[model samples]
Target: MNPLRILLLCHSFNSLSQRLFAELRAHGHTLSVELDIADSVTEEAVALFRPDLVLAPFLKRRIPPTVWQRVTCLVVHPGPPGDQGPSALDWAVWRGEPHWGVTVLQANGDFDAGPVWAHASFDMRPATKGSLYRREVTQAAWRATLAAVQRFAGGERSAPALPDDAPLVRWQPLLRQSERAIHWATESTTSVLAKLRSGDGQPGVLDTLWGQACYLGDAHPASAAAMAEFSDAEPGAMLAVREGALLRCTVDGGVWIGQARRADPPDTHPTQRSFKQVAAELFATEAAGLPQRPVPLQRSPDEWGELRYTEHGPEGARVGCLGFDFYNGAMSTARCERLRAALLQVRERPTKVLLLLGGEGFFSNGIDLNSIEAAAHRPGDSAADASWRNIQAMNDVALAVLQTTDRLTVSVLRGNAGAGGAFLALAADQVWAHGSVVLNPHYKNMGNLYGSEYWTYLLPRRLGDAGAKALMTQRLPLLAAEALKIGLLDHNDEGSRQGFEERSLERALALASSYNQSGELAAKQARREQDEAHRPLALYREQELARMHRNFYGFDPSYHVARHHFVHKQPHAWTPRHLAVHRP
Candidate 1:
């Protein structure tokens, strides 16, 4: 092919544009680079080059019509053909789009409203905005531009003409701090999870805890029952450490428990309880407050207790606020069993609504892993199986809560929600959290697998499969407000316990009273539909798992190594990527 003259126009001489310029020049073409897209500069550059093709690889500003008309100017947009403009990668990642592409189009007066010349598409991975643009789009642009130049030189320009009725150009504005605020009450674990993953390894999901700007990272979605089983403190309180894990609370009365940083100095206050400890205490207290009733266990009837409920007239009954102390709780299997039994009793109630308002400063922090370890280490005959059974029991309990239909449960949270605590909130029909609350699912940081069953179904239902995988596998967290935007919570309001309780109860009652008791039926129908849709995929997954286990079960040193690394290492020692690899 004959050497062709090319004019390379860029908004700035940034790294990306510079690389493109180098590539073009290396191709033995007569190339001139213009660092500005200003009308006069672009016109002058186009005139001087008199090139066969004018290419723009990374120009942010608009190019004048004079310059485009003067030469065969082509713009390379870093997104799919339809998804043009700034923040393209951000939107793509946020939406969890399957594919991303680079679009080479004829430059026109209107920005990104050009006729398509050539396009290259690729699958989008769980990538950050910077990574997607830097790696995928940048490379695609390089390859596409080179090919386009060759085609133009050969007079094979098969550029598709822009239709008059094409969709209007769309743009996403830069993310603002205010827009990133976490709204606890109405935000769901899935919604918050997406936001956290969207902001992974960056400044992270933004939030103001007690009016202090806090950048959150390393979050994931877990089951409320799992969180409850793992934590032993009030929702916001720092409970005791089991092995190396630390537990906290979610907006709802669930547990948020995970590993604590070894680098950070330990709190000297003996009164401090880890999230698991506090959650166990709250669970016990709530269970004890319940009205005694005969409930059937596996094969026998046991006198189970129900949470305190008060009638609200035709509106429905309101469960009394469950008090929780962020600082005190006993961690034991018996406690977990009791808490589970109590919650089950509450679920069995014939009432239409149940509002679980945690104490002034906290909610349930989840279960006690220390107690779990202690039980496992006991000279028992089957410690491993027993431990696994405990986890299964927790999963079953969480699933029960998720499947509950008789009561429209509302978890009104006021503090930190971590791990299973966050999942507990997920099980509820509605969840509310104060602005001061912080929600985290730090499961990977803990040594155990993310055993919560609710996540398997709830996450995919709320945020799609890709989003759910990213959130759970990546271990990210979401602030309250961001949670709201993503549809995690039903309603959110910033205020005191009484104020939040009043609002949450009103909303829950409205929902419970208005709709006929068809939620359970509807849920079953939805489950059936999803099951039908995913049957093939589920079978494939099961097959894959079986094959993986067969291949690596006994000899998988990687699993042990990962467990050791996570259990022994400090929180700040690893990045988000490292933590995600080990998350169950």
Candidate 2:
């Protein structure tokens, strides 16, 4: 099929949109992005870009008839054929549907009732709505969208009619907070989990904790042993606090509620209405009264945690795998400190190689903006101070990675990475990622943040001066294959997420047992010494932090303003010029 001009219309350039953009561009399509700001603005974009097709990967509003009638428009609905709704995933998850899918259909007067162009389905997994959408929904949507786009590119304008058995009007209304409310006293652990998972990451299950109204989410089932210990506790009773989560007993078992947002009164200012934060932090006073239950850094698979360490292979050739699965890959000051401590501890192990497998769905996304925003409300803390502390903690983690010269350190990106996280990967001797991983290596999008994860020292060495400068300004997502073609990635493998994990482990073991492992380590040490002599790492850090200090404490409020909007989930007023190519 000949490549065609495509305009991506989305509510926000979310993960799905970024993946579509990267994949479509890789297929040689001329693409532009226009946020679904307003009907008139979208019409103007259609006039300017004159795209052959408009692909709506993620949108809350329907496309205007004036634009869809003039050009072929494909709406990527996150549902199977005949499923029409704004909250398809939420409903599917809440009901524990065995299967779900993505459908590519032509834009029509009725929402999600258009002629089906393509559809792809996947067996449902027990996970949060956000997790399902990021993984299964994204992959299925890409496949279906690609097929639909190909059909259009091949001059197939007409879509086949829907089956006669199809419902004439199967519209599932948006799932409301009332539907997601949890009944702690009556519901079992599994039931409570379903309610929380369905609303995880947005409009979390509205509930009262410690007599204060709040939205609950990021729940995990307590271990069987832990639940057994709390079996006698009254249902709905807060049992304990562990790793920043609150464990509450259920009728059958117990669950750890990891995150929450305060449901402030309507009279409260929007800015003061809390965004999601660690549940323990959100209700710090109450959590303090509960007993603290800390788990070992290495534990059973049934246990839940943000960080875990495991050793592979025998004695001398052993490989250490440290996985840090932070929620949404947001590293607050505390998380960074925890990660740094884990890195240091893992280094002490008698292992020749260390694998840093960062989270599912995201490797890391730099400093936690939400945490910093919440800091503003704390009694003695300010956002600026919190930002400084978080960045420094992040820098400390990167530095620890850089200093691990004795072992062969590998940063395996099992998921997407952006901003300082991208550079943090470079701190390792080699960076590996699967083909599906997307990397946003620049931090300008977060209010022109001059990032400080030793990127000045790490990036320039990887891509040289000019290439590094160019990448810092590109402000675009780079696919793993393209990253390998350039110097951004050392290795890229094509495989499913599970396959990638297996292969990455195999590769890491191979590196650990390499014939010239000692020689490679020596060479690495020598180069580090030479680089240190040429320009101290501290100098690079100092220079980077100088610029970052301005971003955090300087006159320009762009970083703070952007952070507030992002944490608050504010709707976009206009598309960024970099994304909306039709704009001046």
Candidate 3:
């Protein structure tokens, strides 16, 4: 293919754009650089370049339609075809997408909507926003530019029109200060870790020390795991230390202290202190925020919405999963109520099987423990009663799954399920887990009840009474294979269950097409049997589970021994578990 003259429009002479310019020049193409595309200079720059094609690698300003029409202006979007917009990289990182790439296409007046040219894709790794761009995206963009150029020059530029059926690429707005508030009482360790990773090496994770804003640097999952395990320490307490690595704490553990500044210097050893000392100080500060008076639960507007489903056939129904993942704070009573409403709306359809297909790697992370703790601390509030009610609300949703008629609810577990999270998956008539998935009731580890309200009912029903007791007491995690053996999961074939529900949905529709009569009666009968079989066990379990939780929290250890480790000059060998067992 013969080389074509190219004009590169970029926001800055940054490393990414600079590299692209070098590659285009090395490919023997005539290249001109336009560093800025302000309204005044854009036209003049385009006219001056007078090249066959204009490529914008990281240009901030939108290219005018006239300029794009005159020259074959192409925009290299760092996302999937439909996902074209500003800050695609940031959004992808925030959403924890596993795949990301660059799409080089015609730059039309409409933001990222343009005819296809070529794309280079890559898998998303555990990387920060800046690191991800530097490693995967920058190189992919360069490759895409060359490919597009080659196709255009070889007279093989075929316009693949954007599909109308493609899902609109969801855009995430820039993170706001309010959104960054570290609500220790509301967020889970996993979610907090993701937030830290998303903001790694940038603005940094928002944290407060002595009411002053502090930025915590990027922490890996393993490091966060260490910190979460020691969460028995007081909120904001540093419990452990990894040498020259991180100070593990309660709320935001595994945080690398990138930069610390205050009106007053933090009282410490001046240099690096042990994890216990850090935890003690931080805990004291957090404890001071607790109200002497009861704090009322401030109700917020219900921010939950459901997908509008449409009937596919006489005996078939289709609802888009839309990739809903219930994170740590997602299981509030308000959200549960909204989910109940949504489930009811979909359950009305004359469908045989209700398949939850999306939310890969997460089913639900269970009720927000932080929220329960917060409500419990409020003055004039019956924290104990509130906690019980919240658990009941969660259990209700699980029980509803068992009682739903006219459809066999099948949970396709594509990732980790734990605590109420695991029970949510178990509530379904049948659970199909991907090979690498894990199921565990982790409440015991967190010093909470064995399982929430549904555990009483669902656990013994699936696993015999003896099995449920063993699981609850041991707090052992079950891998997918083991979970299948224990009857927790019905099917666990890695390949066959890869996209079981989706593939089965297609097959169901085909069968529905040939149905001489409604299969609604059969579905209802099946649901009735399940409800009857489980109702007695669920009631008994609910009582026992509540008793377990009350007992657990009543004897809650106040001062964390791990925090003691950091307080005293103890070796890092004292794991969080050691301290937790000896808690006073």
Candidate 4:
């Protein structure tokens, strides 16, 4: 089939939109992205690109009928057939729907009621709306999208209409504050989680905390063991705090609130609507009084934790595994510092190898734009200051990895890694990834950011100068296998995240007991010494940070503007010509 000139319409170039853009491009379609800022802008895009089809992967507003009627447009809805509205995923999670899906519908007169092109459904996991969207919804949307696109490319004119006996595709309004109100006195742990997870990453669950009204984010059930100690407190009373989250009692059990958004930060301007911050940091005065309960190394993975340490291998040959599961793998200044401290602590252990395991969904996306944006709103803070501090702290972590002359460092990527995160992994002696893992090993996409993370020094060494330059300029996602072929990865295997992690540990243990361990360590030390003698690691760091310092403090505001646009979810005014292949 001939390639179609596909125009992507989205509110913002988010994860799903990016993935769709890349995949459709790879599948031989010419894609040009236009944010749904206004109908006028979209129409202008349509006139210029003259697209054969328009696909809306993520949009907040309706496609203007004028454009939809002129050209074929398909909306990717996060709902099964007969479901309508913007809060489809939110309603599904809140109502505890067992199954969810993605639908490809033609853009007609009605919203989400157009003829069905294709759809893919899956069993819903007990997860937040954000988590569900990233994993299952994204996968389903891609499958359904690809299928529908194939049909359209094959000259199909019309799609199947809704069956007469089909269930009513009732419209769901935006999930509001009232719909998310938490009733601690009457609600159980499950109910509280449903409410919180329903809106985990967006508007958040409207609730009262610290004698003020705010929105609550990520939550997990408190361990029954911990609840035994705080069982006597009032149902809604804040109990304990740990790992940047706060615990609050429910009638039968309890939940931990990881982050919060409030409209009343004294430091922020009154005109500013609200501020979202780590739950612990937002209410520091109240948090200081809460008891601290840290999760031990052997604890279960059921709650919010930024850092965790575990060990594999027997007796004399141990391999340490360190995991940092920061939200969306976006490390803020404090989080980077915390990770640095953990890395410093773990390196002292008597291990032959160390594994850096990032979060389950994302290995890392780099700096925490959300935190930086919030910090910039404070009385004395600036985005540049936050950016500088965050990059420095992240550099410290990478520096520790670079200076590790004793044990071998390995990065086991179980999920996607992008920008600085991808380069951070290159600091390791070996980088391994699971099959489904995707990597975006470039920073230019983020407003020409000259990324630090010792990436300038590490990436070139792994991929060579020309290859590195090409990779950075291409701005595409590389699967694990493709990355391994390009020498960006040491090993790539197909398996579940859990299985891959298990295999990585086993491999590490085996390497720990290998006959070449001593020789390998000596060779590694010699190579490091030679490289240092040639230029010095300090020099590399200084040179890289010098560039990054410019990215932060220099007159150019590109990096700052890009970060602000990202955090604020600002719509695009025009698509980047690089990705707009159909552009003249």
Candidate 5:
């Protein structure tokens, strides 16, 4: 097949766009990206690129009719053939649909009424819109998009019509606060969670906190302990706090609100944390007054919790699983420290083998940009200080994993991993991932961050000097299979998440049982000693931090500027030149 000149149009070069960019490029497609900040700019980009076809992977605004009429433009909608509108996933989640799909259609004047090119569906799980979009929606969209693109590449002019059984196609408007509003006085825990999660990462539920209106987000159903403790509280009353989340009573159960922000509050001070912040951090007085409902030692899927420790496999050859499921996988400075403590605790256990099971939807996306941005608004706070501390805390966790010499360690990624989180997994003796998982292992995107977490020592060791250089400069998402082929991943569980978990534990146990435990430990210690003798880990960390210090405190404010825009959700000014191949 001939390579097609394709232009990628999106509201922002988000996760979906990045994934598409990497995949299409790998398949020999000439691609360019342009942010749809305005219709005029988009038209100019279209004229400049003169693409054979324009693919709208994710777009908020309508494509200019002038271009869409002249060139075949495919819009990737998050919902099925009949599904139309901006809040496709949000509505499906709110309505509790059992199945959902992605549809690619040629752009028409009426939004989503265009002829369907191709579509793919997936079974739905109860999850935040963010989670669904990243997992099932992404995969389905890729398949449908590939089909549509192939058809275009094959000189096909027409597409198939929507099936008769397609759901009632109608106009669906953007979800507003009223649509997501929660009636705490009457809502159940499940209902409350659905509403919050339907819009988790954006436009949080409008609710009141401490007499001030705030947007509540990242809701989790209260734990068993909290349920028992607040067994009879008022439905709307806040029972207590676990971690940074606020446990508020529901009709039959309670839900935990992890973060909140003021809704269009006056922007008076530069340091007022008006953005989304940890509930406890935002309401310190209220949180301090209530007792902490700490996470339980036992693992229970019923209750919502972040970190859990469990032992798997036979009694004689047990493998300890230390799981940390941070919301959206953004480890704040405190989360890194807490996870470090948990890792240290797991090391003391008598289990012979260990696995670091990160979250289900996302293993990690590196430091929490939102939290660090909030620090910029803190009284006497600076983003530089926050970045320094957060990266160091992440380093503390990585160092703990690197320094471990007793038990054999492994990292099992069930979902996507990026930046320092990807390297943190590499700190383990072995790294394994499910076939569906995607990884972005470089830090240059975050304002050329000279990442810590011993990535300097780890990545090069896995991919060599030239490969490491390519990885940093390319900044493309790699599938688990690709990562394994490049020596970044040690094992691949080419199956379901459940299947991967079961088999990964079995493999870890087998490795522990087959290998000489004493010899493994000794060899590990010897290798560490050898590496230290040549180039100490401290030297690597110091050199990395020296570069990072300049990034934080130097004359350039690119890091801070990028972070500010990210947290604020500012529209993109321009597409990156690397992805926008049309640009010089």
Candidate 6:
């Protein structure tokens, strides 16, 4: 089939849009993106690009009839056929539906009532609406959208008739906060969790923190041990604080609230109104009064914490697992320092191989933009200072990983990774990822950031100087298979998260027990020594930090401006030229 020119219309270039952009382009499609700023803007885009079809991967608004009538428009809905309206995933998650789907429909006069080009379904899991969308919803949407695009490329203009069971699915209205209210007196942990997660990463559950109106999110179930001491506390009482999350007692047990946003700020600071901050920071005074509950680094599996260490296999052939599950995978300066300490601690263990298992939804997206933006409002702190500190702390973490020469180390990515996090993974002896993973290895997208996780040295070593330069300039996402083919990843395992974990452990065990394990370790140390002799690691650090320091404190305010708009969720005025292929 001949390749077609496609225009992507989206509210923002979110995860789904980015994934689609990468995959469709890989399939030989000439694509351009136009942000859904206004009907006039979209129409102008269609007129200028004159694409054969317009694909709306993620949009919150209806397509302009003028454009749709002029050309074919495909809208990807996060719902099954016959299901309509916004908040489809919200209602599904809140209701605990066992199965859900994605439908690709042709645009028409009515919303979500268009011809069904394609549809796909998957079993749902207990997770936040954002998490579900990022994983299952994204995978299903990709498949269905690709199928629809294929059909269109084959000259199929008309959609097939709806299935016999299409009538079974019904439209669901927007999920309101009142319907998601938590009855602290009667609701169990499970129900409360459902309500909190349903609207997570968006309009969170409308609630209060110490009688202050706010939105609550990033919740985790409190461990049994944490709840045992709080049994006498009232259902709504604040129990303890750990790792920037507040433990609030539920009727049956307790739940950890990780983040919150003030519903009614003084209108003085937009950060308060725009982004969610770590709950402990939001309620610092109140949280200070609560008891501190610290758990061991090697806690039980059922326990909840950002950092955890576990060991397996016999003493001589032991394999250590160092896991850091930061919320949403944004590593603030504090988090990076904590992870650095944890890495150093794990290195002391008598293990032959170590696995760096990052968080579930994201390995890391680099420094926390929200926190840096929030710093602008503080009295003595500035975003530049925070950026500098955070990047330095991240460098510390990377240095710790790079300096560990006694044992073999592998960076295992079970989810998406971007920016410095992608390079940080390169600090390991080997990098492995699940097939579903997407990696945005370059940092230029974040306001042309000159990234500083020693990427200057790390990337060139992996891809050579010319290849590294090409990749950095590309500014695109890389799928796991493509990454491996390009030598960015050493292994690409295909499976669910659970299956990936099991398979990775098996591989790590094999490496730990291999007869040539000692030889491999010695070879790795020798190579590191050779590289250091050619150019000291400190020299690389100095050069990278020099550029990064300018990014943080330099005269150009692009980085700060971009970060502010990003953390505040500002609408895009126009699409980036790199993504707007039709431009120029």
lDDT of 3 by residue, 66-154 (tens): 68777788888888666766767766777788998888988777778777787888889765675567546766787787888888888
Q: Give candidate 5's whole-model lDDT.
A: 0.85
RMSD of candidate 6 to true structure, Å? 1.6
Instruction: Tell me model 2's lDDT, rounded to 2 decimals.
Output: 0.91
Q: lDDT score, residue 27, model 3?
A: 70
The runs of at least 3 residues in candidate 2 whose Cα sits more than 4 Å from the true structure, single-residue gaps closed, are: 161-169, 267-272
Per-model TM-score, in order, reads: 0.40, 0.98, 0.46, 0.91, 0.95, 0.97
Write down the RMSD of all candidates, one decimal each: 19.1, 1.5, 20.0, 3.0, 2.1, 1.6
> Each model's number of backbone clashes?
66, 0, 11, 1, 1, 0
Q: Between prediction 3 and prediction 5, which has the larger TM-score?
A: 5
What TM-score does candidate 5 reach? 0.95
Cα lDDT, all candidates: 0.52, 0.91, 0.57, 0.84, 0.85, 0.90
Pairs in steric clash, model 2: none
- Which 10-residue window of candidate 1 scores lowest in summed lDDT? 298-307
Candidate 2: residue 471 Cα off by (Å) = 0.7
The model with the greatest lDDT is 2
Candidate 2 TM-score, true structure as reference: 0.98
Question: Model 1 over residues 323-380: C-alpha lDDT tens digits?
Answer: 2222112213444455466566655555666665543333544544434433433465
Off by over 4 Å in 6: 265-272, 496-498
Tens digit per residue, CA lDDT, model 4, 489-540: 9999876544678898889999999989989999999999998888887887
- Residues 323-361, candidate 2: write the lDDT tens digits: 988888899999999899999988888999999999877
Q: Please say which candidate is ahead in lDDT: 1 or 3.
A: 3
Q: Candidate 6 residues 1-584, lDDT tens each? A: 56999999999988888888778888999989999999998998998999999999899999989999999999999998889989899999888999999999999998888999999999999999989998999999999999999999999988888867676657788899899888887889999999999989989998888998888999889978889877798888888999899999888998999999888656656544557899998789899999989787898887889999999988799999988888788999989998998998889999999999988888888899988987888899999999999999999999999999999999999889999899989999999999878999999888889998889889999999999999999987788888999899999997765588889989999999999999999999999999999998889989988988888889988898899889888778888888887767
